[model samples]
Target: MSEKEEKHVIPYINRELSWVDFNYRVLEESFRKENPIMERMRFLGITASNLDEFFMVRVAGVEDQVDSHYFMRDLSGYTPAELLLTLSQKIHSFIEKQYSCFTRSVLPALKKSGIRFLKADELNESQKKYISEYFDKILFPVLTPLAVDRSRPFPLLANRSLNIAVRLKGEDESYFAVVQVPGILTRFLNIPSEGGNDYILLENVIIYKLGELFELNEIRSACTFRITRSSDLDIDEDSDDLLIEVQKFLKKRKRGKPVRLELSRGHDYETELFLKEMLEIEDHQIYEIPGPLDLTFCSSFASMPKYEQFCYRPLQPVYPPSDFADCDDIFKAIRERDRMVHHPYESFETVIDFVRTAAEDENVLAIKQTLYRVSGHSPIVAALIRAAENGKQVTVLVELKARFDEENNIMWAKKLEEAGCHVIYGLVGLKTHCKILLVVRRDEDGIRRYVHMATGNYNDSTAKVYTDIGIFTCREPYGG
Candidate 1:
């Protein structure tokens, strides 16, 4: 290649900024007038939630490098610090546009469709009574108010945990206190509306009853805020016990330093300053979003009865091949030909059935599989357990370090162990993300090896949403 041709070569988009641009496209979906109002709102919410994770893990990682005075450049020719600065500005502008779209367009459309989000003051006497009852019965029981003092010390804020900071004042002195929003409870509280409409947002209800939580004569200020910590996993390849090392890292993740602080719109200067000082965050790290702090609640919009007309019509997944439909013997079907299964479009039940059939077959000698992420109630895991119980040599390579799925994977590992399956925690340095299942069966033509390779998890639940591909084959060389 000539020097001019090399110079003209297109550089890959910066992964961080490319992600943000992808989110902007999602946001644009919400602006389509043809889309159902609720669906649009859902898209907007997804965009918000996507950015939250991007900042928490990706941007936080770059920021860490910048903080350590290490200048690392990517294919885009931007250093970590340079990228952080650029991302901060871009995100602020994007969020401003998102808020405007939500408040001006989606909210009005929702109201027109008989769903209303009422302010505390707008609630009628009956509505107030219902909300108050809910507070006393549910919210009040779960809340633990933590006061900031010389003795108490600043409490550790878990990543993405929603918290309300309150300014309480007595006759002589004033102080601050924090109350975490419980994760177990739903974020949206659907209240009875006069017509067909409904009211929601647990935060709005909590803020309405702030005076009840505190014994201050004058409740000076209360603002809802959430902190996202640096949650990128860093593993040492040289560690002797990789599983133990990952567990240690997971524990440390809970107390990771705050990388991004999200505050409600128009947060008081004093409260902002206090948070910045206490959390040791720079000005660029703070983001002020109008409306709710977390947009994951937008998922609830899908449940809105009247708004069903606005969203995409649900479709049932189909089996990829018709031959497997009649022949229940998956091994026999695979032995005949190679089969490719498209997921979200193709039924994952076929995958589950393959495992179930293998577990029950007396001819099957051994089963080996790699698990990245499995469903909470995984049929695949059940099949593995059953195979182990039947005395089949079952070997499972469970990636214990799959992010956010670590705790669930740990639980599954223990369950598999109890069932007598030999479980491996995966390789030390590299994550075993590849999805592979190998089955050895004693057939009429001697022992044969069958394999299943998929682009997605064997998790049945996520198969309904994420698009993925899977292939089942007994072809020579490749299958073995």
Candidate 2:
């Protein structure tokens, strides 16, 4: 309240708002005419994915604070409620900009480049016949229409699952039902085209054949909708077993309170109200997307082989990098001098080979590493298991709390434990974020230690895209 105190408090951008701004900066890449069309679409998808996480974790946390009546102002000097309101406005405007770029710029460019998305009405008789048969053979059998009535409560929809809200005319009165568009199938269906590749959204195909599912009643209206649920875990550090607690939390995460609801543009008013009431969300939380419910699908669509010419040329990293070109032995290369590997430019295989060598080397005594996030079929994890199986001591500190990667890490932890490796589930209330690998070997001189440190996770999948620096050293202080 004092003038001096107020002056000392430097005004800073709110973290939530700053993150949204960062995503907007990413979105700006899509608007650039110089960038390849496919790359621009990929950038747009990245923004949508970023916004989804922002709502699930950041917005959900602030809403929690507001609900608890915690009015304390952040360093940015806005109360929880005020920040939430500002975020709602900022996010709505950001989404509008996202769709504007998609519709005005990306769609036209894609069409010009020989890729097109045809609507239901645009299809010819042959296409319609093909779609109808395809729907019956492929979609009809898999689709389950869940009717919402007093007897049957609204289905507990999973977070982010796209569903169709169908309004049907009953014998007496009208009611609503839900038909989940299966995520298992592809989002875009490639049908026969006269010239270039033409595709139809699976949702549109489903909407066109809704009468098949509801033969008893007349279909009135149907629209695609998706919900983002709160996924930020509330950890109890005092739990008896952190792994089991995290497992329980993971289940809760799937059905956590709905924080965001996305509906197709021009959604029915009655249906929208029904959804809002069921999800317990406000008007600001509801986003009426002008195009698709989720633009994340655009990333995969951009990777089509037919659109390869419109995409940026892929870069291949140099194998057996110059740093280790002189020596065949990885240990000798590190022992001679500290070597650095720049990722996505120099291959990540150098790092994997380092671990594989440690696992296979006769003189190597122990291998230790920290795993934060890894690929589904991680070569690094396989090498660690090999090290343990080779009778060398292997200690792996698997960070189970890694966001969206808990399940994968858990599976790897169990595999490592079964393979006789010592697995640590990280420290309580703190994430093990550092990327480190230490190999102890009994050299002729004495016991020598080699270390591999990096700025990114040991995930090979990400290494192809992320720019990271990794260093291999056998000298003191660093290896210490």
- Alpha carbon lDDT of each predicted model: 0.85, 0.91
Residue 430's lDDT within candidate 1 is 76
Residue 218, model 2: Cα distance from true site in angstroms: 1.7
Give the winner by lDDT.
2
Please identify model 2 stretches exceeding 4 Å from their true place.
1-10, 476-480
In terms of lDDT, model 2 sits at 0.91
lDDT of 1 by residue, 5-40 (tens): 998676688888888888889999888889877778
| Candidate 1, superposed: residue stretches over 4 Å from native | 1-10, 170-173, 304-310, 475-480
* Sequence-dependent TM-score of model 2: 0.97
Q: Tell how far residue 277 is off in model 2, in angstroms.
A: 1.4
- Give the clashing residue pairs of candidate 2, or none: none
The window of 10 residues in a row where model 1 has the poorest summed lDDT is 471-480
lDDT of 2 by residue, 177-273 (tens): 9999999999999888877488899999999999889988888889999999999978787898999988999999988999999999998988998
lDDT of 1: 0.85
